[model samples]
Target: MLFRVALATGLALFITQIKLDFFESYLYDMRVRLTPVPTTSGNIQIIEVTPETVEYFKGIPKAEHHKKLMEWLIPLAPRAIVYDINFDEILGSEKNKKEFARVMESFHQLFVLTNFLEMRGEEGKLKLSEPYEKIKLFSGPKSSDTANFAKDGVTRRMMINYQDQVMLHPFLASQINTEIVDKFKIKGLFDFLETDQVYIRFRPTGTYAKIPFHEAYKGLISTQAFKDKIVLIGHNLELSEKDYLMTPYSRSSIAMTTTEMHANMFDTLILNNAISKAPQFVNTLITILISIVTVYIVFALSPAMGLFIIILLFISYLLISYFLFWPFGIWISMAHPLLAIFLCYYFFIPYRLIIENRRSWEYYQKNKLLRQVEELKTNFISMMSHDLKTPIARIKGMTDVIINDGFTVSPIQREALDTIRSSSDDLLKFINSILNYAKIESQGVELHLQSKDPNNLLTDVIRKHEFLAKVKKISIETEFEPLFPIKIDPELMKQVFSNLIENAIKYSPEETIIKVISKEIDGMVVVRISDSGLGIPAQELPNLFMKFYRSANAKSSPIKGSGLGLYLAKYFTELHGGRIFVESVYGQGTDFVVELPQN
Candidate 1:
């Protein structure tokens, strides 16, 4: 999980570092469009230099017309006048230069635009283009120019400082009042961008109060409109694309005029509004956190729920970004965090599915092989038990016949015949145990259930084990507590009791006591068979009832028997909804307990 988050975060940060222009521009423009335009303060106004005004002054030089307009505005006493036009060339006669300089100097507050074009010299070093000598001399310290736009030719940000010198908008703002100038000195005027530039918090396009230059020149616009207003004079005519620039508000078919762009900058300064990009580390942290959460949610829920959560998260992130951009003027990179979430979920879910499917297939194949092996084992045990049962029974019968025949025989022959019969009986008992175990395991055993007295059932099992107990000289004792009748498979119950008693007689020393007890307790019947015997070891007791399991002590002892007795006993008892348990201590004694539901 950590690896997935790290990979996703790395990929997101890499993409953000690349700063793809189109993607970034799209997001930035969308944010601009969605933001509500703020109410205008109407303190700044534009006087457009339209084509009609240029045509009106065609016979005369453009500089002379600018001089005449300045003459008309000198009496209005405007707060300040900013020229967005570039007067960077030697124009007109010497008389025109002196008259323009004189009129420009007369204004108490004035700023002029100076174009500084960066060009490579012969040595490939950048050089700044110089402004016209007359314009530079007249504008003095108030000279400033527009900043460079992005590579996409869209003006999303404004330059605050270039080459350690203040740019136009901030320089103009500093000249407004001592307080604003102090703010400029302390906070500096622009919010930082990826390239250390600042974004322009643009109002809606053409939002400022605008008037045609022809109208203002003809005295159609009243002087009061210019009073106390910072007036901007620039060309808005559709002469060429030279004065037109793309902005966040620019559409495929429309672009804003450079005059309007400068006016927007001026308005931003007045309102003290700036948009700043969030720190890179902040964006990276958000990306990583969202990526980890996406991975966890996808794994923890169903695919549909995960997708829903992703959509919800996307919307929530958009809201957060919008709030930051709108009210707080903070711009954070949204693409990376959203993309991190998408890629983490998309890649991880399928990878996990493929892994789980492969494991399931392996388990299926293993189970198939195990089933085949179990069937073969059941068939082999069934056939071997059947084939051995008949021969062992016949051996016992022939030995019995010989011993009973009327004939004279030596004492050694008589003892040999008796030994043969006993050996045959033990072999037959072992074969029967194997057959019964296999039948039960193969689901071939059918129960003949009836309501039978627990005492009678246990007594029958004891009677069957009497001969073996007598041979070992072990005394069998019984304690009964009037057990209620229980519904059970009689033969299966008898087999359970027979195995317990036989094991007690086999493991006990001669003359030891084997006690059988039955009682009703807690709505259940419990039977306990205990013996003074060489008890099972503590470590081997857990596996004692497992199929074909024998303790080390039992394997080395002289007593001979198959190990299926206790395993089959446990199986048959459970089949009748009963439980079996054992308590033992090494070298002391052992007790086997069976509990059956009374019903």
Candidate 2:
């Protein structure tokens, strides 16, 4: 088990680091997309430069237009304002410049966003675009707002430390402030951050209150909603992909604008919820443990129990991983561990089936050997019984000769000779029963079907057993209805009937009458022979006709029986297309019923 676990774990973790990282990131994105941390994006607000504002201002508005917009927001008492728009040219009039300066100084910290496009010219020379001299005139730090999207083209991280300092890069403005982690230190972020870490956790779009730039300037803005709030201003023209980018929450191919992307990052930082990825070693260890545990239970337990446990373990792992990702912001290895579990199930179930099959094969082999031994024992009994029949017949013939040829010396000698003859007859009958059973067991009994009178045949069988019944002081009663002359093997049916009558007489009490009835019904011949005798127990009824199986009473009593009588009776009756069964109540009475198909 240990070896298999090790091998499977090795194979599963053998995936290249690149492949593993990709899948791990994919799974993380899925968790974020499905069960994002429930947060109220109540604090964030965006003021977009919509197409209506552009049309109102006639083409994209100029810097003086932004200055006018900020003038309207100053009375709202915003904590800070972010301008995602660029000022690449000098203001046309000094009047416009002074108003822009005043708007910038009105807020405690106004972040003016900048864009840097690094491209190669035709001569392979670097082309850098510098902001207009007017942009430098504004106060406060003007950081580049270019965000770094991941390799998969997903914009998941909003802030990364630069020159050992965590700087607010892009865009953000807030209306509410609670437990904000926006001021988290750079050194602390570096201690846990990875190059591939996803720090941006965005709530659903439309969580923030957004208004058009023109609407805020036209007395449509409310001071109560913006008071002491952070205000962000950006362009959100319809059909504009110039600033649009993909966020973690972006579905299909629909990407959110870069302005919205930055807004989500600021919202996440403020909430102090920066989800972190566990180290690579952490995933490796988890893979090893998951593989080992799966192998231990599946390989060591029964198939049913193993399968049940695996399902439960799989479900538990999924729930744990999800909860850890959410609210806890801990990313563990899901695909790696789950793949290991799948591999275990794929191989272990068939291995268990093979084990069960081997056990079944062993059982089959043992039963076959037992059957062969039983056959050998029956063959020995048949051989010995056949040998005894000749000797018993000779003994009976010699005793008869001595008594009939006047060879008896006296009354005591005559009685002794008679006893010898009777004992020889009894021995011959026992031996014959064994030989008959052996013959039938080998399927050697051939039926000789003849249309014999059913009543006559039954009467002959009962008459043959009359002497035995007389000896036991049991009377034989016959009720024979006029029956059809059905095709039958007379000799075989006679023995079948004879066996029933003899058993009745042997087990019945003195002065009890055994009734033998024969009749025709439903194109069939039915015979019922019943006696007030030692009845068979109900539990023993099913095995009554099994070869060498005797009733409990018969086995315990001194009554002479080979236990093959009823078995032979059933076989002979079936050979003639008939069936025989017995019904009995313990210690009360027993009845034997026979049914033969009539044509």
Candidate 3:
């Protein structure tokens, strides 16, 4: 069990480190769906560079179009104007650059997106894709780099910094809100990006207010709409596939635009609500704990119970994870914990059961060998008992001849001979008891069923035991009902009754009465033999019919007998479709009851 738990924990850790994307992606998407929709900050607005606007500037150069758009936006006195479009190449018009630079210089803060492009001639060199030199003169020292994507090619995190010639260029979102960045002491771009990468808390799509570039340029939207607003100018229309990026909110049927993604990043930075990955050690601990608990439950409980517990734990863990992401903004790894549970349930549990089953089979085989040895011992004792009975019978016959065949002997010799004869008779009775018990144990009772009156059978049994009863001065009384004639093995029934009566006589004090009662009830024959002798001890009554099992009280008595009589009696009675039980008190007498099917 320990090994399996360790194996599962180690396996979960390894899988978590490697991060199988197929599973993790699904989990991440689930967390995204669970996140509450973000409220729109009304301070931020998007001005989409639509296809209509692109077509409107068909006759004009792209730089000229930007110049015209900026010319219109500059009069609004916006707090900041952010351009999501990149200007990598130089527009070959000095006149357009001067005009754009003049319009950009009029604004209080103007930020243009830049990207770090790999230089073609250099193996490991990066250069900034900047706007025109005249345009850059007015844009200020920091240009936001627009290069941030997860390993899965999704834009979930923003590149807070980019390295160019040993210099750091902060991300656009960070540059827009330098106070938040400095306040949080955010450092190390990718570390901060990956570890503190915020899940985009998105408002419903199409909810962020947008104005068409042509509408803005044509003076259709009033300047009041842009007053005191942070204007983000970018293409909202699907100009090409490269213009779009996948996000957590991206579904199978829809993808979020890069402009909307920027808005989300901007809003996240403003709110300071970036979701972060839980620490590696914490995740590992959670995975290991889950693995160990799953293994323990599977081994400790029954299969059905174990399955129920596993499912409950799984659902509870999921709920916890959902709560953490939805409310607390923490994205702990769910893949590994879920995998650990899966392997423990689907793999480890079945393996343990197989091992247990093998052990059980081995145990059964060992017990079978022991039972065979016991059977051999029983058979040997039975054969020896049969052989001794004959010799004892011959001894009795010789003793009888010597004592009774016209021989005169002293009283002492006659008494000695009688004692020897009586001892031999007792020995023969013990041997017969052993043989009868062994016969039932080694083989089985074979009954010869005959229709017999219950009263007549009881009478015969009582007559057989009358001498023994008289020796003890015990009265044997009978109460018989008009029992219907039933089929039974007469010899076995006689033995059963004789054993009960003899036991009663042996245990009872002088003049104690032993009562035998027979009756019919509910289509069954019932016979009850109750004795006022020393009743069986309450603790010993349960095992009273087991072979050779003598009670504590019986062991201290002077009664001379093997303990096989009652065992054989119960065996024979049950073979004829009957049940036997004894009810007794510690000092009171016992009542042995036998019931048989009437058929």
Candidate 4:
């Protein structure tokens, strides 16, 4: 059990640690979109560069655009102006550079974007895309990049510093109030603060005020309108070849630009709604719990009940993870934890089967004594049958010879010989039944199948019982539709027919009718022998074919019967790949049906 528990838990953690929670992270994005915090518009705003504005400055220098924007906004004394666009290359003439640098130095709160180049390994000096000399000198290498795309290429998280490169939103936030970003400095999945990350709680689109640069440059808002609010400037969707990332608010072909992403990150940090992955220990505990619980359920319950509860367990865990994690700004492992539960249930099936099979073996061992007693009974029946058949056969033979030799005898003596012959025949039938039963017990029934006409078999059985029917003053009626040949054991099928017809004659009253019918029904050969005489009670019908079982009516009647005939008939009929059934109403009538597959 411990080994299985360890295996399940280890597999779960392996999937989780490999960051294979793609589906889980997708749900996290869904959660962010569903339950967004209130818009934080009062503290932040955006200035966008649209296609028209980019066209407006097509032939002009990039420095001229930055210079005009700085000259316009410096008078308002905004909290900070962080650029989300890359200004990595020097452009324009030297006069243009010096002019932009002078305007940029006037606003001490201005911060420009820095781009980081990724290397093969983690340890190194931060490789930066060198911005235009003037912007770097004024903004002091501002890394205003808050994008952290997960495995599915969606920006759902933000890191304070990634691979020795500081991010933008928190950088500006720390400058505004060091304590604002300090509260979110919690340890991440591996207790590594060097690359700590948290989920960004985004707001709906239009949550921030954005103005095209043409409008902002041409008096979009009053000069006093920008006081104390942090401003972000970057590309708008109207621009071709623009930088964009997928956010919770993004859909296909509609993504947020770098400016909007920064706005959301800034708000998430200040509002303190940053979600973190649940602690590793909590995740570990949950994985172990699901594994052990599913294993226990499989071991303790029946397979069907175990399957039902396992399904319920899966749904319940999902609900719990959604509610607990979404509201609390933490995400528990969903994909792999569910995988753990399923693995435990699925892999433990064979183990449970082996245990059940062992238990069945133990039960069979305990019943050894009962099986031995049954063997002894079959042996005794066989011995008695061998000893009794000789005398009965001799008596039947002697009586037949004397009766057929034409010896003259008195009427009383002749009648006595006839009685002896009849008694011997009954004894011979009883002995044969016992011997057949013993043979069946020692070795199972094996059929010597042959294709025979069912109609012929039925007529032969009726003729053999004609004398008894005549003696009881019962009329035998036949209605045989032409039947197809069926594969069956001839002798065994004949025995079945004789047992039913003889029972019909023995139980019937004088002047009753016995109907024997054979026909093809539903592509199979069917035979029914019905008697209008002492019918079986409904309560005893279920056990009528049991070995040596007699009904109450039979016990009270004067009929000489051993009660094994119908049992043998049923056994033989089924061995021929056919079925026998009895239908009777108490004190009314009885009917026997035999159906065999026909070729």
Name the best candidate (by TM-score): 3
Model 1 pairs whose backbones collide: none
Model 2 lDDT tens row, 1-599:
56676776775566323255445657777888888446755665688888998788876766687777777777777766766655544244666766676666656567655443212242212221232323322211212113322356665554443323334432232124333334433111423232212366666666666898788877687777676556677777756565566555664334666666666666655555667667778877887787778877777887789889888989999899999887677777788788778776777667767978999999999999988887887799899998888888888998888888977378899889978987887788688888888777666778778998879988887777877788778888888999868889888888788888888888899989999998887878999999998799899999999988988889888788888899989988888778999899887899999999997
Q: How do the predictions measure up, each by TM-score? A: 0.57, 0.70, 0.79, 0.60
Better of 2 and 3 by TM-score: 3
Superposed model 2: Cα runs more than 4 Å off: 1-39, 50-59, 83-102, 112-209, 217-219, 235-242, 245-253, 262-337, 353-382, 397-457, 479-495, 517-526, 566-582, 595-599
- On lDDT, the stronger of 1 and 2 is 1
Predicted candidate 1 versus true structure: per-residue lDDT over 167-279, tens digit per residue:
56666665553454544432224444321244666776678778887777777888898887778887766666766666676652237666777777666666666676778
Where does candidate 1 stray beyond 4 Å? 2-16, 54-61, 88-97, 117-150, 175-196, 251-254, 370-599
lDDT for position 578 in model 3: 92
Rate residue 434 of model 1 by lDDT.
Answer: 86
Ranking by TM-score: 3, 2, 4, 1
RMSD to the hidden true structure, all candidates: 9.9, 7.0, 5.4, 8.5
Steric collisions counted per model:
0, 3, 0, 1
lDDT of 4 at 281: 76
State which candidate, 2 or 4, has the greater TM-score: 2
State, as a TM-score between 0 and 1, how close model 3 is to the true structure. 0.79
CA lDDT for candidate 4: 0.75
lDDT of each: 0.75, 0.70, 0.72, 0.75
- Lowest summed lDDT over 10 consecutive residues: which window, candidate 1? 137-146
